[model samples]
Target: MTDVVSEPTTVTGVDTPPASPARGRWDADEHGWFGDFGGRWIPEALVAALEELTVAWKDAMADESFLAELDAVGREYAGLPSPLYEAKALSEKAGVRVLLKREDLLHTGAHKIRNVLGQALLTKRMGKKRVIAETGAGQHGVASATAAAFFGLDCTVYMGAVDTRRQALNVARMRLLGAEVIPVESGSATLKDAINEAMRDWVASVDETAYLFGTAAGPHPFPSLVQSFTRGIGDEARAQCLERYGRLPDAVAACVGGGSNAIGLFTAFLDDPDVAVWGFEAGGDGVDTDRHAATIVGGGAGVLHGSRTMILADSDGQTVESHSVSAGLDYPGVGPQHAHLAATGRASYEAVTDTEAMDALALLARTEGIIPAIESAHAIAGALRIGPRLAAEHGPDALLLVNLSGRGDKDMVTATRWFGLDPETATTDPVGDPDSDPRA
Candidate 1:
């Protein structure tokens, strides 16, 4: 990869706090460097586009009319302020107080809708007629297509061929929403490859097309931009905890692929020294194995997908393919801001194996009747493993907030196969005993 290195510079108005708690030392600098990570590392062809987007985003954030419109659209169309629920059954089983930020209940059934809606609105403000995006598990693709249709903008999404098959339902959903779905067959045929194709398209069509990056990774403005849009996940959860339970959660957790949802939920609690932040990365088998996507836990610093961050790279600095059962978490690199967070000891990250995540998924489905996306299941698994220890130290009152990043409707195929469910009969006695009390 071509590395773009630059000296750090001071950020001015860009550091303005959102509606949530002040970021304090967590804000990115002027050139978008969040400590040693985050910067515009791309071919010279895309520099102008990034610069333009940076200015446009800053301007839009300053405009009250634009802000109001984004808020209105989010509430009326994309479902903002998703409710927070105490997962009583889950808490009882885990031996800790578990509260779920129900992003899965949002309009598009994921936190991705928030970012897409904001970017789509910005696209319109920039007079772009079309938008292009890259997706892994397809939540972002579905959200982008939904936003494009709502805004009367043409949309095209690039997805990995492997993911296209695994997430075929989402591909159909995107097509139904009027998006052109392109299956990328290059380089491991995963999220990174899709991003490569999207960046190429963006470079060629910079004038009339805006690249609505799905994650809080990529170059300068994107990481910051995506965070600004999705930070509501944490902001709302923080307030909900205060109003409902009379205090903030003792700890917060989310899955980290490209780190958007994790960053979104972590932003509001970053300044709260008492609240511990945790990120769970996909561990296909284990971090000790070659097959995994635990970037923060297993990778080193390198440039990938336009930002210098923690990535799975070889001794020669070549990109290494990452693996995970959940397509959303099968990425080799993480968001630059996440790298900074990990480096500064602001957040702790761990790897959750596929078996662990799948078990957590089943547990949630059985106990709480909530089937979370496999990506989110990683967070659940991590929380379950750590919850009891935390409870031991802090007593039963220790509260853990988990971001249910997406629903599992799109993952039924994978789930069915994993659990060996009878697809023909649509019933199985695999997980629990059928002879026992049905509800028990």
Candidate 2:
């Protein structure tokens, strides 16, 4: 990065601009930033709703009373300022300095809670009585349910039948939180189907309900809204990294499941050209195989569920199935901002295989005593693959921060069975069919 003198600025509350164009694109009047590919591409019916949401969010951002209430809830109820843990043990094992942003410690055990809370607050202010959302790993479902219970609102979570079957515990948790969990059996019976169902509900009940989208994808305000709500992760991580280390980390990494967590951590560091941003997408069997969810790495432009983003679509533009070890990372599309970031060379996207992510899961558990969600394991996988490359190319002193997006408590049973581990006994490697082991 080239250094230059600052310029005089006249805007009352705005800071002076950097000497160079922002590494990521920004709209001063719109108050939205893009990497070059993000914009609203949706049906006409959603335009009004999205514009309303944008206006409401801007108002909330400016409302001191709303900010005070949100701040109090975040601190006293949702546990803000989650720890930026120094992963000394894992760092030693990886041969790189690694830090983990413990978003898992937040209420409902994932970063999804942050967006849900902010959106739910807006829902309340909008005088909506019902909140609807879609979930994959059930993280967002659980988070929405938690928020609904906290604010005394009706919550409905649409999940695919496959997800409900795979994440039974999360289903029960949502029920316990007083939410109605409806399983969508149409289409592939996965996240996409659930999203379609939620959109239908939203379109029908736009007057009485608010749809709290789970990730930084979907229509207009969602990518921007979720990013704003999740920016705290990066904000805290940036400050903590500076305080702990003498400077910013060489790179920040996270898994890109609809790209919420990635965008969250990436936004704060976007202006810093020296720091690299990496997003790991799930490579289920392998990127070479037919069954992977690496949309950014292996997909093409197409519209899906109201957004014009890169999706796993066939040549005819039909949506295709996606596979991943973690349900959360199995979506066929990613947030448009991520697509833009990739297009502009502002960020890099990599695919992490199921075997690789599972290996990362075990490595983090044994080496750091912290079991991360499969979604987060993708970041660990990225660290393993990218850490050595960066160290060899840059230097050994290069710093790496992996967003440990969520804990793995919800995945124990599934992981155990998938790895063929005896529930009663300790295990190291995950279970796989010997005949199905592609590496073998």
Candidate 3:
């Protein structure tokens, strides 16, 4: 069961995970099983390739030169050690000393690049000349294309037809990065569809291509590998918290879709007995309405996208379509590590409605002058819901670190539609005067 900070109960009650060295351990078994959540469930055609990747990954883990190269690339190119900014205005509103790990400032935007650069480096080690990936919101695709361009490797990104139309700016960004963008028309024409198409490509091109998984929900090595690279988000925040606040935070929150960002932050605080980790999921209409992506709350255990974890699936084990205003958080399943963390009570998972996320997006924009990507807004929503509660429970000094995962420039159109602001006049309008706006 998880510890409860008595207040408004923004997060549900669960038994706290026990304090043990192994309770929140990271590495999976050789087969990549994370307590039955991760393992290669791919067809026979890709097994050998995966095994080779597993071995090379192990070697890369021990190679000091490889690590130094990765660190150099992260700092000099992709922008590691992203600032931990005090959200003073939002903090005052929330009644907690809130800090944001600003991943939004990193090159190519968002936390996706942390894993992309690492995987691209590994691609060279594997002697692969081509890299392929799937994207929903297109941030990952842009990051992947940037990495491939840097490495001079051929890159292809599969995106849903619907997503390309919605997130077209990112589509153009990916194209400009010289990556081929393939629009998938199957199924719901979203992330899962893109994944299906990418998997087919991998099956046929395994020898020359590495399937660079976009998030942390895939088979074993990917879940672990992506987290290993992006854990820098948490690592930097952990140190920065100590330097700035002189103590660990009461809680850390991040939005969970396929859960790369959340896992990146959570893995850093797993062993800290006092630091609680929380994950907020997308609640489209609301989790109770069955139109949401609150997988941990409304879903059952099932296999999806090559991993066995919490999933939004029907009785026959077919994955359900998830909806959210935030395309990035609209997945049917979460990473295996998140499932284990939730099951063991190492963390609590909550849902924020689309309205709540949009409200938080606007709140941060007005109060802090930062427009969070809609996916990151879920974390902002959690802060708003949990901050006052923490103050009530832990007093005024309650500190919280939120992963500010991406900037919201990509969501201006969505924000414009959600808040009903005229794009032509909204930029010059005063910040807090939503009443002066046409929507009011």
Candidate 4:
């Protein structure tokens, strides 16, 4: 791995600017390379736009007024500093203390709002009147639309046709927010396809529109920018943990799709060697099978969606379609920074199967009365799976922090199909007797 610079220079069209103050240990270097993983890989037409964005990002980060505006908007509108709740019942069940970083309570019911608001503000700063985005499970799309409406920017979201059907509620929500929703039917008709379409639109409309890339996986400035906006998750959780429990968590866990939430939660803890960072990928069925989105666990290093990262690809290095019960976790590639972290042994990643994740969703709902998004369920499942080992190693005092990245309201359709909650389609009573005791 390349040694990271304390203060790295920023990249312009061809020249390099002087070193700017570092945002964090994991911030990418000049040219946007995160170690060997991230760098701009795109058509020549998009280079100017990326260069513009890179400069804007560096300037915004250095601007006190911009920082204050973002913070004020976050606290006043998006619900900043979300609560850290100790899941007593879950802790008892897992044999280790479990603390949940409740990002699900944020506006639009997901952590995607943080990045959206930041990029939306950036769009305004750049004097852009329109914003475009791509989404998988639709949380990011909804968040983007919400931000655009709030900021009075024209919003357009490209979503997978499959996702539009599965996550219909969120698609509707986005439309109701006055954003135009376009369903991409090409490729796997999923996140990857949506991104391709969005990128195509961005290349054509670079001057008047800003592409609000959903996750931290995209090229260059996006990975760093998304991390900067969402790292508040870790910053808040770290302080909350210190204040509430007097120490950092023994382990920090989050589900990794394109890796924004995991990176967000892992950022503040990366320098703390004693704290283990764990990322759970979506294992649709299982990793042993071909149907899974477990990029780090099952994939090799390759470029996908403009960044060199671990990807689900076939023998000829072609991208494979990834499957997952949760739409948000259905992706073939991960963020370049996650690739760097795993490569350097600063973090560990594992695949959580669909069955395991659903079981965890049910467990959390019954135990804590909190129905987490399926993406977040993967983290909960991973925490449960590793809890015993943590307990054995650290005794009963082992504490695990799991990022609840989103609420499950948008996932009811998928969860209903998975859990057989609908009587019309019921083959078996998945929830047990309706007449029985509610807690039983």
User: Can you give the lDDT of residue 76 in candidate 2?
Assistant: 93
TM-score, model 2 to reference: 0.90
lDDT of 4 by residue, 1-440 (tens): 23533321111222221112256556788888878898988888999999999999889988999999999999999999799999988888789999999999999898999999999999999999999999988889999999999999999999989888877888899999999999999988989999999999998999999999899988888999898888889888877877676677889999999999999999987766677889999999899999999999999999888899999999999899999998899999999999999988888999999999988888888889999999999999999999998999999798899999999988888788888889887777586534222345
Candidate 2, position 344, lDDT: 69
Q: Write the per-residue lDDT of candidate 1 for residues 163-272, one digit (tens) a residue.
A: 89878899999999999999999988888999999999998999999999999999998999999898999988877877667666889999999999999999987766
lDDT tens per residue, model 2, 179-242: 9999999999899999999988887788888999999988777888888788778888877777
| Backbone Cα, N, C clashes tallied per candidate | 0, 1, 6, 0
Q: Please identify model 2 stretches exceeding 4 Å from their true place.
A: 1-36, 423-440
Give candidate 1's error at residue 289 in angstroms. 0.3
- lDDT for model 1 comes to 0.89
Compose the digit string of candidate 3's lDDT tens values, residues 1-440: 44533332222222222222222355477777787677877787888888888788878978999999999999999888799999887887789989999999999879999999989999999899999999999999999999999999999999999999998999999999999999999999999999999999998999999988889878768898888778888888877777666667899999999999998898877777577789999999998897999999779898887788899998998889998999999999889888888887888899999988988888887777798999999999998789988899899799999999999988888888777687666556423446222223
> All candidates' TM-scores?
0.93, 0.90, 0.92, 0.93
Query: lDDT: which is higher, 1 or 3?
Result: 1
